[model samples]
Target: MVGTAAQHFVAVHGVGHGAWVYYKVKPRMEAAGVRFTPVSLAAAGNNGKKLEEVRSLHDYTTPLLEVLAAVPAGEKVVLVGHSGGGYPAAYAMEKFPEKISVAVFVNALMPDTKNRPSYVIDEYLARTPPEAWMDTQFPTYGDPPITALVVGPKFISDSLYNLSPVEDQALGHLSVRPGSLFMEDLATMDKFSDDKFGSVRRAYIVAADDKTIPAEFQRWLIENNPVAEVKEIKGADHMPMFTQPDALCKCLLEIAQKHAA
Candidate 1:
C-alpha cells in the first residue's frame, strides 16, 4: 500500500462537477494527510458557463490542462476522473505520459485508448437489450464538447442505481449532462498517444447502483482500457462524489499508493 503521508491526487469531475465536488472530498483525503487538486472543465463548477457552450474536447480539457501545465516538468500526477472527465484525463495521459502518476476511473464513462469518446455509449446503442437509462435524446443546451447527458435514477431504476446514495441525488450537484454524438466521435483517433503514454498505471471503481452507466458497461470500459486494478463499490450509485466521498477518496488514495509502489 502507498504510505498514507504526502501523496498527490488530481480529482476530475465526470460531467457536472467543476472543482467544487471535491469540497466534500478533499477534506477526507487531507484529514488522511493527502494532497489533492480538483479541476473543472471550462464551463463547469462556478465558471459561469453553460454546458451548451463547450464546443469541443479542448473546452472540456481547459481546467485540467491548466493543472497539468502547473506541474513541474518531471512530476507525474495521479488522475481521478468522474463521468466524462475520463476523456481529458486520458488525453492528458497520452500527451504527458511522464506527468501522470496513475488513473482512477469512477462511475465514469471510460473510453478506449484508440477509440473516440463515442464508443463508450455506442455499445449501448448497439445493445440487443437496449438501454433505458436515457431519454429520447440528450437534453439540448448551449454549445457542448461531448453531449452532456444526465441519466438520473428515476430513468434507470433502483437496481442499477442501488449503489448510489440518496444524499447525492438530494444535492443535485451532478448535472453536467454529457452529449453522445460529438463527444463520442472524439475518441475515434488516438491523436494523443505516444510512447510515453498509453500504458500508465490505471484503476476503475464500479458503482453498483449506477443506473446511468451500469456495472456491465463499466466492466466493458475497464476491459477495453489498460487498467491494473478494478474496485467494485456496492450500494453507491452514479454520483459517488455526492453519495460516498470517502469511498471515492479511499479508492483514489489506494490507487495512488499502488502506483507509487
Candidate 2:
C-alpha cells in the first residue's frame, strides 16, 4: 500500500455515471491503505438530480470544487477523471491548481489551455443524433447556450466500450445522459492551457485497446503536454474500473506513489 499526500482519492466518472461507479476502485484503494472520496455531479450518479439541471461544465464541476476546497491545508490530491468527467477535472485544475498535485486522464478528453473540451465532442458530432431530434428535444431537457444533445453525452458511440465485460457495458448504458455542453469552460481558464499544463507534472494511463478515446489520442494528449508521464495498462478497456481493477489499482497506486515521492 502506498500513502498519498491526502488519504482520499477524488474521482469523477465518465458519462452516465456518478461516483458510485468507482466503487470497485474505491475499495481497492482503501484496502491498499489509501482513502477514497467519490462524489456525484449535480445530475450525476444517484444524486437523484435531474439530467437537465446539470447543463454546463461549471454546474457539473461545482461538487468537485467543493471537495477540493475542503482538503486539509498543505495536503495535495491526484484528480482522477474518467471519460466525460475530464471536463470537470480540467476545470478543477484551473480554479484550484494548487489543490491538485497531479491529474490522471482516463479515456477522457485531455484538453490543454488553448484546446477546448468541446473538441472532444466535435470529433464525434457527425455520428451523433440527427440534427432534428438534437436541435429540438435537447433544448427542452437542457437549456440553450449548452451543447447538450450533440456534444455532451449524446455523441458517445457504443463502440467505445467494445472490450468491456458485460456488466460494465450495461452500467455504461444506464449512465448515458447528454452533458450540458461537451467541452469545459475550464479550458478557457488562464493557467489551464497548453503551455500551462506543460509546466505541471502530469501522468496518463493508456488503455491498450480503448476505442472510446483511442490510444492514439491519449498519446497525442500526453505528447501535447510535455510534462506528463505515461503508463500502459494491458488488455484494459476504456472503463478500467470494471474491466481491469487490479491493473487500474496498480496504475493508481503507482501514480499516487510517484506523487507521494
Candidate 3:
C-alpha cells in the first residue's frame, strides 16, 4: 500500500561487503526521486560488531530487520539483495512480508520454502568448490568455530570486481570485511513459508559476466525458485553497481516503478 511518493529502495549487500557497495547506485536512485537506504550488516563495513559477535543468521540480519520494522504503517520498501546478501533479505521478507513490496535478488542466493534456508548457500558452495575460492581467507572464531570469509585481493579482482574500475576494485580490497554465511544457524532455522516470504513478489537480476556466481549458477537459482520477473544486465560482473551502475540503476528504478508503486 505504499504511495507513489513513498517509494523506498532498501539495498542489502553480499558477503565481505557492506552498505558501501551501493554507493555508486545510491545517488542515481535518489536522483530518480526514490528513497534509497543501504544497510551495513553486522561486522560488515563500519558496523562496530566484530566477526565473532555475529554468530548466527539472526545476528547478521538484525540491522535489516530493524530497518523494515521501522517503516511507517501502509508504506512498503523494495528490498534488493546482492550476492550472499539474499539470505538476510529473505529472512527479513519472511519476518515482515507486509513491509516489502518486492524482493529483488541480484545474482543472489534466493531461497525456497521447500528447503532449509542454507540450501542456496550449500548449493553455491557445491557449485564453487573451496579450491575455487582462490586466495579468499576462511577464518574461524568463537568457541563453536564460526567461520567468516574475507575476500582476498586476487579473488576480488578475478571473481568479484573483474569488470569494475581499478579504483573501485581497490576500494573493495581496502574496505571489504570478514563475513560469515552462518550455515549452521541457517540449517537449524525454520524454513521460509509460502504465506510469508512467498507472499511478496520476487525478481532476479542476472549479472551476465559474473565469475563469482557464474551465469549458469544464476540461471539455476532462477529455475529452482521461480520469480515474478527476471532482469539481465548484459556484460556486467558480480559487482554490477560498480561495473554497470547506469544499467543497474535503470533496472532498479524500473522495478521500483512496476513493483513498489
Q: List, residue by residue over 207-257, the lDDT tens digit for candidate 1.
A: 877766677888888777757888887766777766677777777777777
Of 1 and 3, the candidate ranking higher by lDDT: 3
The 10-residue segment of model 1 with minimum total lDDT is 173-182
lDDT of each: 0.67, 0.67, 0.89
TM-score of 3: 0.96
- Number of clashes recorded per candidate: 28, 6, 0
lDDT, candidate 2, 164-244, per-residue tens: 676766666667554454344433434455433434456778887875566776776667654456788878777777778
TM-score of each: 0.81, 0.81, 0.96
lDDT of candidate 3 over 68-176, digit per residue (tens): 9999988889999999999999999999999999989999989999988888888888888777789998888888887778888899998899889999999998999
